[model samples]
Structure formats: structure tokens, C-alpha cells
Target: MRFIYRLVFALSLTLGVSAQSFAQGLIRDAEAEIMMERYADPLIQAAGLNPDSVDLYLIGDMEFNAFVTGGQNIFMHTGAIVIADQPIEIKGVLAHEIGHIDGAHLARFGDASRGALATMAMTVGLGLAAALAGEGGAGAAIMASGSQFATLDMLRYTRAQEAAADQAAANYLEATGQSGRGLVATFERFRYQEVMSRQRQMEYFRSHPLSADRIGALRRSVDNSPYVDVTDTPEEVDELRRVQAKIIGFMVPPAQTFNRYPESDTSVPARYARSVAYFKRGDLDHARAELQTLMDEEPENPFFRELEGQMLYESGFIAESIAPYERAVELMPDSPLLRIGLATSLIAAGSTEQLESAKAHLRFALTEEPENSLGWYQLSIAHQALGEQALAELATAERAFSVGNNVEAYQFATRAHESLESGTPAWVRAAELKAVAQPSPDEIREWNRNQRQRQPLAPSRGLR
Candidate 1:
């Protein structure tokens, strides 16, 4: 449930803008990320794309939507995962998106500037065309009509792209020995929504139009697929359910979570959900009890231990939190978030020995997740406690830079540069930060003008 706002710097580099301008609400759960990566890897590989080349980003939104941007990045909403009836359902969705990528549709659309718009006018607008999702009416209107005017052929283009992707998805699933039933099931649920007004329809329907022909084609593909009757493995099904449970627990009201998974449900996922709900409500005793039950059931489960540590730490039991966090890290050494948790607890312990330990864990964590702002912030705190002022400033600069606070980043970089020995890697990085953090001449002039405009006018013509 704890998420981070990740600005895809690559996007800015490709589109010629500031990454911070697009604070995509990307959830930073290591477990969820790993799960999604596992789900998409086969499809990605089957599409003739390197698994490592694709980045699956989990958007923390309630709407069932998914999008691909910056060529290799997949933005999937949590709601999509939550609503899926089977693992294949989500896979079908992924396969279709990958189809779009394999076709290079976005790049192609960007290339063809003329002549397509006229042909696209006959198709339904699907209002705002789904990918430009926002919370306001103005955003909807602009995306639906104005801002995306040039790409009005976007509808025609996307429909064609959708068909191509569907066929591609079917092929990918068939190649991977996976069922396409989930894909068909997913589309079937939305077929009727096509007639609804755009505002009333799910964003997925708006973005990925489901026509009778398209659905019929998908059905034929599904029926012909060799794996059509195959279902997810038992283990995969269980994991999917657990993931959905955790998502619902974190996303819904605590009371609703309790109602949905009442005390009668003694499953691990049910306990996990209840624990999360209790923690959110600040009923630490009940939360601890639920966690204890889970621990007693699965003594060596790292996620269970991680939740225990999280609960203890959030409840101000920092010292008590360390043991579970350390144990969790020992059990799940590959999880950067677990290491970060242990490091954070160590930092809070505040002893010199603890600070050194914290630094080591944070260094390892940064190796896995260099752009994590919270990890950098905690690392800076540890360094500051150890009197490593230059290192602390550098860490602070990285943290600020990651979150788009360029002014603060510049100040920290400057301080780091002033303190660190020249010619070292740290010093070189500090210099880079300083260079990137500097405002342009035009920006400086505009800032000065704004400051002057805000100054009190002389009382020369005052009524007094």
C-alpha cells in the first residue's frame, strides 16, 4: 500500500521535458514488482523482446487501465490486477499491450502526420482516448477533443493497432503454452460498455475499444489456441489470490477489509489483510495479534516477518522492530525493500555501530534501487549521525534530485562539492548534480521579474 511517485527520467529524455512534471504514482512494493515481472516475462520474451529491457510499472490507481510509454515501460494499474478473475486474464492484457509494442505503433503514429485523420473521423472518439486519463473535466475535455487533435486519427490508428496486438497476443500465449481464455473473458466483460457514454465507461473500454469483430476474432483465436483449456498452476493461482487480497486490504477502508475477510477466514492472506487493516486503524494490539498468528503458522515467511517489522516500526517500537527486520532480511536477502527496512530501523537506533550497519545495508539496497528517495534519505541521516557531512550532503542531493526538488538538490550538491576532496568519484557526482540543478538564464530572469512584480508598489499615488 505504501507507494512512491516515480518520475520516469527516460520519458523526459525522450520527450524533451522534466521527469518531475510527470509524477506517475508508481507503487514501490518489491513483492508486487517481482510478481508482475514474473507474469510479464514470458510474454515479453515471446514477443522477441528481452525481459530485462522491459520495465513493468504498477500505477496505484483504482481504475482498470494499462498503458505503455517511453518504448519499454508498461504502466499497469493496481485495479487491473485486483479485478482479474484469473492470472491469465492479466496475462492476456499484457500480451495485447506487448503486441502494440512489437508493432511500433506509437512510433509509427508519431511518424505519419497527415492523411489518417480523415479516415478516423467515422469511428467513435471513445472520448479522450483512454491513455490521457486524469481526474478533472477539463483534462478529459482537452484529451478528448483539443490537446490530442492532431492524433484524432489516434482512434483509427489504435483500433488497427488493437487488432494487430490481439492476434499477436494470441500467438504469444499459444507459443508460451498459456491459455487465452482470460483475455477473452476480460474483453467479454466490457463488450457491452462500448455503447455507454465515455464518462460512464471504464477507462480500459475507452482506451482499448472492444468491437464485435474484435471480440469475435479474439474468440476464434482463443478457441483455436492449443492451451485454450489450460488453467493456471495451483501455486500461481494461490499467489494471484494472495496478491489480490493484499491489494484490496491496502486499498479499501479498514472496516470494509474486515467485512470482506472476517475472522472466520484463517488463511494467511486473510490474516495479512486483517493485520494491514488493523495497522492502518492504529489498533497495534490487534495488528500484533494477527501478525503473531501468521508467524505461528509460517515461522520462516519473510513477508510475514516484514509486516511485523513494519507494524512495530510504525508503532514507535523502533528497537523491537530490528530483530524481525533483520530476520526478514536474512531470509530474503534479494529484497532491497527488506534491507532498506532493516537499515531504517538501524538508523533509528542511532548508535555509531548501528549507523555503520545501516550504511552497509543501504549501500546494498541502493545497488538494487538507486532511485529510491526514502532509501537515500535514510542513508543521509545515517551519514550525518556519523559526522560524514560530505557524504550526507551527497545523499541528500540524490534524494532531492530523485523527487524533483532541484533547488534543494543544488544546495546540497554545492555543500557536498565544498566539503568533498576534488577529483574523486563522489566529488565528480556532486559536480554533475550542481550542473544539472542550475536554473537556465531565462528561468532566472523570469524568477527575478516575478519577485519584483510581487514587491509593494511605492505609495506615490496612495489615497492616504
Candidate 2:
């Protein structure tokens, strides 16, 4: 249970189950995903892709990059989102990534990767062996040739993909009644990077390979489009500011955030950033004060109340945190994230009635977000506290399975089967998990690939 408690805390702070859970460098926050979907769904719809089939993930790294892997899954870096000044800018990036998906670029990349690796291995291997055998000049020449071949192949393919994506992104913008100006501006910002050596350029530039000609092509597209001069709605602009503030507050040092978002700026985004900065720095009094001011300004804002709850709950105010967490959930009943926060607070309170309430919240949250490992973990604790031993084991098994810990999942599922009656839903579910206790890597990959195809895109909590 103590480990469960820590897992919940880590989930809150890092938007991940554990450090190891993010081996793919993903940050699975409900808010971030929602923001991305809001920007992407329109492009996807315009591109005639099924929204349900396209899964979006936010990369944890600060580098500016976006790419689509095998399926319709799009990965965008948090740093890119944070750096963009408007939702439209991110929308542009999303549009380009979707272009790659629509064009089957990932499959092409896979094919190219196979051949490139083989070529590199043969030439580089020989080159290294030659050098190691005292043929330094011959080795250098051989290695250079191999490296050049691989690099040129990659650069050519990526450059072509980038050009195609740029054109496709512009078309999506035109079709969706959105401006390509954001896309043009975003790329223009990176135009200077073209002068740098490819190795010295940012990952985004390296992967997307930009050039003056590419910029000119994009500019021409933007200039010809009817929506070129259009700007983001007031609501969209406000959301972008708040999202950026939140990212900066959480990602940067507290002192730096406070300095950037000084008290003189009483705007919602400024206050939000300062509140999170205060919380992160253990300045509980300041954090609570800022959150209270925010709540006073917008009593119905679920995110404001959610932050208040997070600050209280994370600062060890378990009993007091419940009220705000509960309020946030009430305001946004459909938000699984808020529900999980409330459930964890209730569980931490450790009272019989609180445990019951916690279970209700956790069950509701899990119903909407079954893959949420933290939700499953907390639900298990709640079930155990309520003496639902069978259900508790099942929940623990689910949490383990969600986090890729098959051994723990298997053990817990087996124990769950012993307590539940035969043929019951809980018993049957446990049996299913028990059967796939040690899923092969390929099986996991296939299941993940299929799950994206099956699930509907969850609506992001609207910008407030």
C-alpha cells in the first residue's frame, strides 16, 4: 500500500507511472493528450482519417520534434508544444505529422531502415576491423564511405518526406479552414538552423530536414491560401498561454518560473504558473494563496480547483485536499484525471466512509481510463481497505499489467481467482490476465497497435 501511495504521487508529479514506465519517453498526462487532440482531430477529420484510429502521445523530451510511427499514432514533443505561442502553431505541426501517416511514410521509413542498417553494418564493421588491425588510413576512408552512404540515404528520404508533409499540411489547413501561417511561421523560426551542420541542428531539424527551398515552397502555399491571414480564436490563444505556463512552471526551476511570472501579472496563466512554481518549491503558503485567488476569480474552473487539490494533496494535506479535489470532479464529472485525484485523496484519509467514497470515484475513473496504472493502483488500495479482497487483487493485477510488470500481474491475478466465485465477471477477468501473464514483446506491441485502432479518442477537458 505504501508503494501504491508512492506510485500515485509519482504519477501526479511526472505524468507517468514510474521512471521505467517511460522507456519510450512518453508523458501520459490526460490534460496534455486532450490539448493535442483538440489541435489534431480537425486535421485528421479533414484528411479523411478516423479519429478513433489515431492515437496521440506527448513525448517527454524538450526537443522540438513530431513523427508518426507504424500505426496512426502521432508523437509530439512537450517542448515543441511549450515553445509554440498559439494552438494553431501546434495544429500546423500535427497537420504535418498526420500527413506522414496519411502518406505511409512510417512504412517507407521501416523499409529504408532495414536496408540502411545492413549497409552500415557491413561497411562500418569492415572499416572498424581495418582500423583495429593498424590500417588507419584505409579504415578512415572505409568508415567515411559507409557513414556517408547511410547518412545520405537517410537525409534524402527524410527530406523528401518533409517536403511532402509540408505540402500535405498546407492542404489540410486549407481544407479545415485554418491558416497555414502558423506552419509557415514555425518553420521560418528554424530557417537559420539550416546553416548549422546537420549534427549540430536540433532533433526536429535533423529529422525533418529543412532548407530555404522548403521554406519558399511553404510560403507560396500559405500566400495562396484563403485562411493565410486568419488568427486563432480568443479562447484558443488563452488555452495555449495557460498550457505553456503550466509546462514551464512544472519543467523549469521554481525560482526561474516565479521570476518569469511575477506577482505583478495577475492574468490567469501567470497566476497558474506561479502557483505551480510555489508548490514545486515547497512554498505551500504562497501556492495555496495563489490558487485561492485563482478560484475566487473563476469559481467554476475545474483546472484551477484541480491544481488547488494537487498542491494540498502533494504537500501532505490529505484530509483538507479532499474538498477541492471533490469540487474539481463535481465541476468536471467526465474527467477521469480529476476523479483519480479525488479518489487518491479519499484513500489517503483512511476512514471507512472515505474508503467507500474513494472506491466509487476510482471505479468511475477506471471505467473511462482503464489503462491508467495509477488509477488501478489506488483502486486496489481502496478495495483492500473496504475488505473486497478478490476485487483488490484483481485491481492490483490490472495495475501491474498496465505498467508492464507481468510477473506481478500474474501473481495477483492468480490470488484474485482463489477468492472470487467461479463464472463471475471479476473471476473471469482475472482468468484472462492469468493466461497472458508473460506476454511476449511482439504480443505487447500487437496489442498496443490494435488498442489504438479500437478505442475512441477521449475528449480533452475544454480550454478554460
Candidate 3:
């Protein structure tokens, strides 16, 4: 679990969450990503999209919004996650966004201005602070003026397009044996948004432009569906609650988290939120206590281990943090972020044995997440500490390339190539980075068009 950011911090909630205080912006978590994959991949596949090709981004903003600007990308706000009462509700939203992707709404709606919202693509563990800090960050900005183009809700749709999406969402739900009741319920809850003043309206309704006819058509299809009685599974419900708790614990203020899940609420989700809230409040003792209680109840859960590891790592207990991070990787080996966290802790320790192990872990992690800027950053650090200057320089170039720093990437790649053994893998990669470092203006324009988005990829999950 991690957020895309400086590896010094940015561990994810219950998944090596960085201790960065919750703020409005963008983030990534493995747990959240897998959860989304489970929810979205099925719908995306049903919509004829390649599941692996599609991307899901978790927005840290509080606004209840989800959209597919174009292609296989879906942006979901944390507010939508917290606002949802169950997993199916969020799935409904995912299905709707998939509808947009299938319909190629961006192409039809003139997505020429779409490249304005730059993002941290090709990463799993991320919190692009430079991109998500509203109008100021380097991310998601209009290149000409760095305007908050998408932040202020720029992706409006025609009423007909929205209605088509509604019907298409219903079709996918029916095909997947999932109910649209949650979607209907979600929309109905905000049915009044249309009548509210634009200032008072939710971002979703404003962008979607809902009407009674649209709702009525969707309700009719849902009411007539055979799967209308279907609901979220127990596992889905549990995970959704945990995701909500963790997001609230991280994204919401500690005061608001305490208010929402107060002391009297001893439920796991409440405890989870409070644990994060306590952590955010600098009450490590209380935070550990709450987390320990959770660990005792579910000893097999890796998230507890990841959270503890993150806390210890950030607290400067570099040696102590290794055990839990190692255990987390052991439990969920497929999670690149957990491996990155373990590698990070090991790199910080700087032992010969630890650095070697960190190198191995990073090789595996970087393979799975080649675009993780922080992973490359950590790899660079590990290589430097291990006295592998050429490899370190190559890793630095990779990191620079991952973050779109073409000039720096080119310079470092050239330096690495000069020292690396010819015909080696490192040399080949350095050559590749240097090759694309100085793209033509048209190529740069095209690359940026395909890359701009709201956020990054998957990482460790289950904040509860």
C-alpha cells in the first residue's frame, strides 16, 4: 500500500500508507486498485473493453464524481466511495463510466481540450502531490495557463449521451448478473440536484445533467431485470466498508473522522478510521493500540502488517519496520507496492545483505510497475548506496523518464550508457530512454494526449 510520492513517505492506509496528512488531491492504493479491478474489470469486460488495458484512478477529492474522459480510464472520487452505502453502488458508477468508454463519448464530445488534465500514468502506488493540489500542482493542469480545467468539472455530456450511457449501464449490469438497484438508488438520492442551484448541485449531476426522463428509463430497465434482486456479497460489503473507513481516515480530517466514527462506535470500520485518525493526530500509542486490536482479530490480514510497518518506518524504526513489510509481501506477493515498501525499508537500513535483498525486491517490483517513478527513485537510491554508479545513473534516468523529465532522463541515460557494459540489459534500457528523450514536438503532443489523466495505478488495499 502506497501513494505515488516521495518514497520517504506515501505509504498507503493499511498497505504501507504514507503518513502524509489527508488532503484533497490524487492517490493510488493496491488494495483499492484490486478492489476496483474486481468491481470494474468484470463490467469493463462485459462492455468489450480489455480488462488489463483499462485503467481505474482513485481521486482523493471529496466531490461525488466519476467519469471517463476517453479511452479505458475511469476516475472515481473518494467522496463517491464514502457516499456509497455498499459495493454495488460503486460498481454501478463504474458500469456507468464503462458506458462512456464503450460509447467513445470523448471523441464525440470534442476531447481536443482533454489533454489539459495531466496525470501520473503507469504507476500503482502514488499520491501525485504536484498534480493533485488543485490549481497549483503541475498535474491535471491546462498547459497554456495551468487552469483547473477538470477540477472545476469540465467534462459535461449531452442529455442524450447521458441517457444512452444509462441504458448501456443497465445492459452491462444485466449481463453480469449484477443489480442496477444500487445505481438507481444512488441516482435517486441525488435526483433533486437538477432542481438545486448550480452552486448547490453535486459535481456528478452537473456533469451528467440528469433529468426525470433519464431516471425513469433507467428505473424501468432495472425494475424489469432478472438480477434486480441481486446484491453485494458479504466479502464485497466488508471490503467496501473497509475502503470507506480507510479513505475517510486518510482523506477526511481527523476531527471529521472522529466525528463520523466516534469513540462509541467500536465496529471494525470505526476502529479502522479512528486508528488512522489517531495516527494522523500523532497519537502513536492509541493508533498502535487500535491497529493491534485489529491485528489480533484478523491475524492473517496483511493490511494490518503494512499499516504497522508504515507507521514504524515513518517513525524511524527502520530495522523494526522490515519484519512487517516482509510479512506483508509474503502474504500478498502480487502487490508491487508492498514489495516496493519492503525494498524501501531495506534500502534505508543500508546493510550489505539488506541492500542486496532490496535490489532483488526492486527488480521484481519494477518489472511489474515499470512506470512507478518512486520505485525507480528507490531503485536509484539502492544502487547508489550499493556503489553501483552506472546502474544508479540508469535508474535515475528511468525515474526521470517515468516522471516525464525528458531532458534529465536524456542526460542521465547518456551518462549511464558511457559506463555500462555494452549489450547488457541496463545499456539497452538506457539507450531506449535516450532514444525517446528528445521527441519531436508532434510526438510530444501525441504522447501527452495519450498520457494525461486524473491519477495512477494499483497498490496494497483494505484500509480496515
Candidate 4:
């Protein structure tokens, strides 16, 4: 069944919170991307999907739900990471979402409703207007409204479509040599919670609408499958558990999290979680000790090593922070967050020799993840340190403007103007680019027109 996905915010609860508030922090994005490549990529490939073409996004919400937005993006709430039991469970969830994509569910829905199309158009229109006006809050509100509209549209999907996705997900799981049991297990977890008090039931269940028949169907599929190894290896399972614990440790109260999962050798994740709790509670000494102990136990684990560096950096031990970050980069060279951390610390330490390396690292990261505004900003800073003032200003202006960094953009533009020779071609081009970044009547009109062109046509209804 084709359906539009939507997210309904409690206005009273989120009135003052803008959508930008939901953007994944730099560190968080790095962690998420790593996990996606490690686990999600394989499952997506098994499902006969292109991993590179699919955009995975982290939604800054604590709800245990994930859904597709339009036909292009997969939005996963942070809560899903915290609650999932294993990497396969996450893979399972993503596989199901991919099932929707592979089944052309979004296109089917897009072809079904005019109202949804108009909603999408208006949503994009409002977003462009907000961007032009420098009203990030208003833009977020409109984007949220658009998601809600899509969800409502999806709620109308036929049982057959849902069943088809379920079956396809199971097939993909089998083909990938992963147990389809994770799907059943995930559904069972949500199903068990369905009987809880209204307030206790997560938004995942509210929208997913679990039924006895769904559970029955999953069980039947699992029972009929020939694969026997439904469980992950101890190491793989531990990583999943640790990832969840770390996320929850960061999000939930320290006392409550520790109380739920005490520190133990077998439960290294719980220890890590407690370490984070200590860090958050401002007990830096204890936090440092906890992380140090973990590092001693697992000297080669890149995640723990990275956490140690993070602890040091956050606690203001700038000089002491470089070693662990450097070690982590050696262990996981492709990690952008680790590179960002290393770059930031190098800049703070005023290491002129490392500036070029920092620039190279950030430039590489931008190539892989162009939407990372922070990388671009850091790249600009690196260029500045290298005495490339004009280049630095342009990169900074481009990044700051793309992500609504108006004040920074304006400042960079002014600096670029002063740095260039008065009558040269470079100076004129810099001024023009600066104008493009800044607010102006002509720019606003152009932005509006561009938005309209990008808007999707209304979906046709009554096609079930």
C-alpha cells in the first residue's frame, strides 16, 4: 500500500523548539554514519538496493520509530538506536523501510493524492520563504507540517501493501544471510508494549498499528523459513548493545540509566553508559577514571578510544586530548567525527604544521558528506590558517549561508571583500558570491522560484 508519512508534533510541547533543534550534532552524525555503513549497507544490498543512492538521516527525537520521507530519505529517530537490541534489529528495521522504497510505495502514494501534493508544495514554499527571510523556526514548523501530512497519507495504505513489505523484508533478510527473526522480534517488542498505558506506548506503535494478525503473520514466516542461525555473533551483538547503551546514557538521566544497567565486565556497554552519565553530571574525574578503565580493558576498541578523546576534549584538557583522537583516527581513518575532533584540537593547540592535514581531512569529509555544514566551516578556518584568505572566506560564506549562518556569512563576506585587491576579477567575483549569500529582494525572488520548480506534483487519489 502506498502511503504518505507524517509527524505530528505536540504544539504545546514543541512550540518554542525549532526544527533546526532536531539536527544531529556533529559527533552524533559521525556515529550514525559509521553504524549505517557497517550494518545498514549490507542489508540494503541484500535487498537489491543501492546503498550510495539512499540517504540515511537521523531525526533528533527520542521516539522508537523510523519512516520514509517522500521517496528519497529514510529518517530514523535516535530512540531507535538506544532501544534496539542488536545491529540486525536495526538492519531489520531499515530493511523494512527499504522494502517500502523497493515496492514503490512512496511513488504509489505520490500518485494517489492531490492534497498531499499541494501540502508538499506549500511545505517547500514555506521552507524557501523562511530561508530567504532568515526565519529558521518558521521553516522548521512548515517542514514538520509536511511530514505530518505524509504520515497521514501513509496511514491509509491497504493491508496488502503492508503485508507485501513484510514478506519482502523477510526475503531480504534471508538473502542477506541474516535471520528474519529480528523482524519478528522487533515486532514482538512493540507488540508487547502495545498493552501498556496510553502514555507509556511509544509513538512507534501509535503509528505502526500492530495487530494480532501481524504478529501471527511474522511468526508464520519465521516458522516457514529454512535459516536456523537467527542470532548474531557475540561481538556483533555486543556492539549493537553498546551503541544502544551509549545513546540512552547520553539521553536519559544518569542515575536512572545506571540503576537499570550496573557496570559489569559482560556489560561493557553499561559501564560506558555510566561513564557518559558521569560526564554529563559534571563528575569529570570519575568519568575519566571510568573511561580509562574501559580503555585498559579494551585497548584496541576504536569506539571506546574515541569516547576517551571526547571526554578529554569536553573537560578542557585540550593539550591532553590530541593523543587519543590521533590514535582513534589511526584505528578508524575514515571516521569524519574523529577527524573533526583531531582538526579542532590541532587548531586549538595552534599547530601550524597540522593545519594542512586538517584541511585535507575536512575537504575529504565534505566530499563524502556535502551537507555537513560544520565540516565546511572547519575547512574555511583551516584555509584561513594557511593564509588563503580569499578561499577561506568563500568556503565559509558558502557553508554558513547554506545552513542559515547569516551573521557568520556576512562577517566572512566583509573579510573577503577587504582581503581582495579593489579592482581585480577575483574581488568582483567575491562580492557577487557574497551578495548571493546575503539577503536581498532579487535573491528572495530567485529562491522562491527555485523552490516552486522543485515541488512535486499532487498525487492522484482513489487508486487502491
C-alpha lDDT values of all predictions? 0.72, 0.73, 0.75, 0.64
Model 2: residues with Cα > 4 Å off, grouped in runs? 1-10, 13-25, 110-157, 436-464
Question: Model 3: how far is 106 from its true place, Å?
Answer: 0.7
Candidate 1 lDDT by residue in tens digits, 1-464: 11232332211111101112222333556566667777788898899998877767665456687765535656678889888988999999999888878888656654343334333221112221121122323323332343333333243336778899899999999999998999899988778887898668665676577788999998998899778999999888878877777776667778998998999998877888888788777798998898898799778888778777877876889999999999999998987788888898899989999999999998997877676666787899999999999999999998877755566678789999999999999999999999998756664565455445546573233111
Listed per model in order, the count of residue pairs whose N, CA or C atoms clash below 3 Å is: 1, 0, 19, 17
Candidate 2: tens digits of C-alpha lDDT, residues 1-464: 00111112225323422222322233455556567677788899888898877877564556677765445767577789887877878999889988988888757766667565456545644553344334545655665462623342453347788889899999999998999888888988888898999768875676677889999998898889998888899988887888778777776778888899988999998998888888777798988898888889889988787777777777788999899988888898987778888888899999999999988888897787676777887888888888899999999899877655566687789999998999999999999999988666665565555446546485432211
Candidate that scores best on TM-score: 3
| Candidate 1 TM-score over all chains jointly | 0.80
State residue 346's C-alpha deviation in candidate 1, in Å: 1.7
Output the number of the lDDT-best candidate: 3
Per-residue lDDT tens digits for candidate 4, residues 1-464, read 11011122111011011213333211243454566667777767776777776767554456677766565567677777777777767877888888887887766654445456556545644553453345556655665563643534433445666677788888888887777777777888778775776457565655355677987897788667777367788877776677677766676677887787776443677787788788777797887888887889988877777777666776788878888888988888876666766777676666677787777777776665554555666777788888888878867775656555444565577688888889886577568756766655555555455545656464332111
**Clashing pairs for predicted structure model 2, backbone only:** none
lDDT (tens digit, per residue) of candidate 3 on 1-464: 12233221222333324444334345667667778778887888889878877766566667788876445667777789889998888989889888988898867644433543333122211224343223323332222121332332556778888988888899999999999988888898889887898777776776789878888889999999999999888989999898889888877679999999989998888998899889888888899999998989988888778888887888788999999999989999988888888998999999989999998998898788777777888888899998999999999898777766565677799999999999999899889888988656664554454344432353322111
- The estimated TM-scores of all candidates read 0.80, 0.80, 0.86, 0.74
